[model samples]
Target: MGNVIKMDVYRMLRSRSTYYILIGLSFFLVFLINNSHESLLDSQKGLPVPKAIVGIGFDGNLLSDQMSLLQFFKVFARSQSFILILAIFSVLFINHEEASGFTKNIAGQVQKRGWLLFSKFICQGLFIVLAFLVGLVTVLAAGEMSYDEIVLGNIGQLLKEVGLQFIFHLAFAGILLLIITLIRQAIVSLLVSVLLCFGAFAFLYHAIDRWIQQGLGIPDFTMNNYTITGIISQVSIDSAKGQLIRAVIVALIYGMLTVGLSVTIKNRRDL
Candidate 1:
């Protein structure tokens, strides 16, 4: 597994397409952060920034009307675009390997299919974290360039937010791995992963919440609460203990189930 992870990481770093996407995502996230900074400053000029950031940390000093570091971080974290980027990263990572028949070659050298899945998960998870760091730096640079104040708000809270993001992205990688492992086609797998992630997940959340909870009269049963977005969406320093626990549970459940199923399919299917 160690050797497998190292090789995958090496291949990922070597891919030109990886760098291209990194450059494009960094620029786009920076633009988004800058644009949000202006709008937030305008609308929240005299308001108290919500103490509990919805997905990260909120601006504690909204009265000053400047974009603080935490608020800027929140801008990037709370956007669904971040989730889309993770899905794209995972899909492309695996899809490219499949298209190149690299995995088949690896299977010939390994007996345990789980080794391949685990290595890909770790490698792609690392890519997600690095991509997020790049976005974070870009946002900070853009904020400072635009004359916004950079407040390194509670370090503990900032670290917690980053940790939650890491878990979410890792689970997203698991989902993509399952899909690409089953589909084994580059364009189709890419399209399916992106659409299922950004579009289908949200739609399923709504349908279940509205139909199952309200129409079926199932008290306190919300499918959205278990969804990938729903789980990650509840992360905040001030969120209830129960909510945070639920988020962790949902993330683990999704990650394990997807990866486990993928491994089973890989072991049984003819490569």
Candidate 2:
């Protein structure tokens, strides 16, 4: 399993597409941060209303240094709804290998199919950590230059944020991996994963919000847990414990169900 994981990481780093996708995402995020900088700077010019980052509706207040980190995160979180960066990377990084027949050749040498897949996912974690940390540093350095003194979260909270987001990406990527592994094609898995990651989540966000306010008398979708990153960033520890539990249960069930289907299909497919 360790060797499999190492090999996947090496291959991932070597892939030109992987590097291209990472470069594109880095630029996309930097664009967002730059746009936010301009908007906020303009709004500070004798205006009362705060300029919103990607329009998450921040009232025009200069973020304290610590809260500036929060603002930076909020900007990224708003764009995350599209699953834009993640979808691109996971598709080309994971599914493209299978579609191009690299996975089958690698599988010939692996001891266990599931372990091999898990190793690939682990490689993804490494890939994302590098990308995310670079992005975070970019935002933090730029934000500090523009704003007042602000200490980002403690190391533990920072790691929690990264780890949780990483898990979310892994879970979503696992879906794409499983789909492509079973179907042996790239297009369908790519489309389905993106649509589910973005489109379905959009629909569910609305539906869940309406249901919660109407049924439970709680008007806070910000405090819900149907989405992993959202649940962590938006919800408080005391207010959303139930949603947290529900999120875990749902994530596990969906992950297991998809993985089971993939394994079943792989066993019967005679590939």
**Poorly placed runs, candidate 2 (over 4 Å):** 38-67, 81-83, 144-153, 200-224, 227-239
Clashing pairs in 1: none
Which digits, one per residue and each the tens of the lDDT, describe model 1 over residues 1-271?
Answer: 6788888889888988778888877877766655555546655566433433222222333323455555555556655556667677777777676678887888877768668878888877887777778877776666666644766677777777778777876787788888888888778888887776444566667777888777889878877577776555446556688987877777888899998998888888876
The numbered model that scores best in TM-score is 1
Provide the global lDDT of candidate 1 against the true structure: 0.70
Per-residue lDDT, model 1, residue 183, is: 84
**What are the lDDT figures for the candidates, one per model?**
0.70, 0.59
Which residue pairs does candidate 2 place in steric collision?
A: 50-60, 65-150
Model 1: what TM-score?
Answer: 0.85
Model 2 lDDT per residue over 189-250, tens place: 67766655444466667777888888888876533356544543343222356754565565
RMSD of 2: 4.7
TM-score to native of every candidate shown: 0.85, 0.71
| Each prediction's number of clashing residue pairs | 0, 2
